[model samples]
Target: MTSQDLLLRILNKLFLGLAAAGIFFGVMGRSRAAERPNIVLILADDLGYGDVSCYGATKVQTPNIDKVAESGLRFLDAHSSSATCTPSRYALLTGEYPWRKKGTGILPGDANLIIKPGSTTLPEMLRKGGYKTGAVGKWHLGLGDGEIDWNTEIKPGPLEIGFDYSFIMPATADRVPCVFVENHRVVDLDAKDPIQVSFKEKVGSDPTGQEHPELLKMRPSHGHDMTIVNGISRIGYMSGGKSARWVDEELAQTLTKQAVGFIEKNKDGPFFLYFATHDIHVPRVPNARFAGKSGMGPRGDVILQFDWTVGEIVKTLRQLKLEDNTILIVTSDNGPVVDDGYQDQAREKLNGHRPAGPLRGGKYSAFEGGTRVPFILSWPGHVKSGVSDALICQIDFLASFAQLTGCRLNQADGPDSLNILPAFVGDSKMGRDYVVEHAFVLALRKGNQKFIEPGKGPKFSKPTATETGIDPDGLFYDLTDDIGETNNLSIQVSEKAKQYQAELEKLRKEGRSRP
Candidate 1:
């Protein structure tokens, strides 16, 4: 054989060998992508930063939550998008600042669906990325249009947004039409006793807390004096659907059942579950099993109940052998509120327990307690056990999860969500340079300095009895020194305040925070 012929044969053989290796690696890469972990986002309602034992609450024991922190990365400076419920949930799912959208505040039970259909939602993005998405628990994000027929199918809710399956409380536990919504229909509705709900006027002859104090099991402290369901006064008026009315004490177990069912059904592969717990919220009635378990009160007992729910979910994951490949996130919608509207003895039975820890304000406030919450990210074997002080917002989940699942989002989707996947997975220390905190007014946190924009509002909210964190002349604070936000530094650090304000305004006008 000629030398030239032998060299050509050698080259041809080498080329074939490389082609075979390329095919092998390509298949392996696809297999790894297919094994992308399941995501479980456990959102607690009205839970404070210090509510969890892991986050430093001495009054209540949260062993299940603490286990999650120990198993993965616990974030110190994480925040929900808003200080209130509806807006915070809106930002969490849509990845847009709630302030950008008007009418995103705490809504009435009969309010219209705030999230428009066909929008790019977190669940929708995940569903499109080959994952089954389910949302169970409190869905205060209003369902249907302004006028919804409770007897009929409720449209444009979790299902319309993106969830493949959903079992949720239509509104809050302290609201009217106190019923669970499975898919688009009220659970166990009766034709003879049809459900009728109204926020504007009294629709039914149901005894209200104001008219009939004799009928109430737990009296309202303020505005939740409209309708009585399960012997508890709610915020709106509702008639009929007695069978569908949810028992307050059974709420925890009911929601837990649905959550566990979702996980079980989808245990074969990647699934995204948004388990929004109503525990520790208004009308704090824990199940009989957990009742009076906490020495604190119903509030503390519900925290224990919430912890049980977490434990149950983790247990299910472990039982199914899905723990290692699951990304579990435990956080609150906002901070804690002892007495929101109901007289649940959360304040009187405080017993020196600090719900917000060392933070100043709670719930409807611009203080650290309002938005700052315990954020834990656990991905067994993938994310290491540690703590991250990096600034993160629940709104970042959409973009971060998108990046994790190899999904590309344009500017229209998750405009404010940054892909802090590195920080999320304990691979990086640096997170966002600054994060926006929303209450009645807007505040910007750049490094340790936080600047609150001047706004005209009540200095203190009478309902929650919380310092609204609002000032007519604006406010500023160095969080590194004053985490409680005791003294205002707007005058002392005038230039720094102005600089943050200017940057905040610029971000507002830009229409998008992430590139």
Candidate 2:
């Protein structure tokens, strides 16, 4: 053979080898992507550790939520990043403590979007990892840039923050703009009657609860007395968008349907559904089917309704044959509150129910009840069926999920999120080295020792009638012995308290907790 012929043959062989290797790696990449499971994170509003039946509530049975615990691992020591809704949600999505940011506090309905655009969020990270992301129901994390024109397309919202599809209540049910926002537009909105919302002053001639108490079906116990919509007063003044306004009674069903639709639409493979429910919140209105069923009035009835919503989602997953490939996580934004704002007989009707279970405080508290919520993780054949005592926090979801999808996170991504995937799937009992709980005051938890930094504030909240968990002198407790946080061990364990105080200051000043 000629020398040119031999050279041509060698070049041809090299090209073929390179092409074969590329095809092999491409197939492997596809296989790994296929193995990634669908994550459905159902976050309940104001649900406490003792609210669900599996978590030891006897007043109201949460059979659907209990089923999740029975199917997989139930975490005994899981907490949200904060005691309030907006802050906890911010932490869960951003993977950074909400305290690290300003203006992350409970936002007004008309407030601007708090989650900055172009930031690394849990859904965004999953989307980059080849997953379809959707958010349904309660979105208290504000919307738009300052004043929002409800008639026009809302920008810098859930869509801009990572969700491919979004069906959200602009704020809370108790807040103004009492309507459902599908994607960027208000659902069922009429262009002629644009929505105008104002937290500052009364916007329209709409009769408020304070002006016309007789018009209300559910009276406000406190400050939820602004605009009257569907015979219920909300926190802010909203006029117009009459057709777009949501009915308190049908909220659970409507949100559940949207969640089910999202799951069905994305049944192809990998998807992330952040289903934040509005049930059991203020204006406690349960559908006719669940009304008077709990025998504990509005609060109890709504809890039952919330359970039904969970059942519907689980049923959809099963019917679609997606249960086996789905990782279902059921948790709450914070602790519970019997009387948030509505005089719905939540406090009066509780015969023997303990909303916070054995925990000390609830809602806007620094105690265990505020941040420690019921956390259940179920993935059929993937996560083993058992109970775990691992100290995991919802803020860790971003990093843990990144690990699951084999996605490499940058140094700036999930700054406070530690990859506790092993503990999440029941593979390990140890989770985080420490977790900081946020409320009126910041509390640090290392192992079983909890330290609350000294602060100046009302010891208790008069509006919600909840303990603020604040003390002029710092408080410390060994949770292994005092789960309710009744005893303060600051004096006894002075050295330990000092160490935790120093660590908390260090973590706060350093900006990121993840090492």
Question: Which has the greatest lDDT?
Answer: 2
Deviation from native of the Cα of residue 44 in model 1, angstroms: 0.3
Write down the worst ten-residue block by lDDT for model 1: 23-32
Instruction: Please write out the lDDT profile of model 1 over residues 79-164, one tens digit for every residue.
Output: 99999999999999999998888889888888889998888999999899999999999998999985999899899899999999
What is the Å distance of residue 437 in model 1 from its true position? 0.4
How many Å off is the CA of 274 in candidate 2?
A: 0.4
Clashes of each: 0, 0
What's model 1's lDDT at 319? 96
Measured with C-alpha atoms, the lDDT of residue 26 in candidate 2 is: 34
What is the Cα-based lDDT of residue 444 in candidate 2? 95
Q: Tens digits of per-residue lDDT for model 2 on 1-515?
A: 99999999998787556434443223333233348999999999998898899988998899999898899899999999999999999999999999999999999898889999989999999998899999999998989996799899898899998999999998899999999999999999988888898999999789999999999999998999989999999999999999999988899999999999999999996999999999778889999999999989999999999999989999999999999999999999999988889889888898899989999999999999999999999999867899999999999999888877877688998889998877888767889988899999999998998999988999989887799899988899989989999899899988888888898899989999787
Per-residue error for 272 in candidate 1, Å, reads 0.4
Superposition TM-score, candidate 1 onto the true structure: 0.93
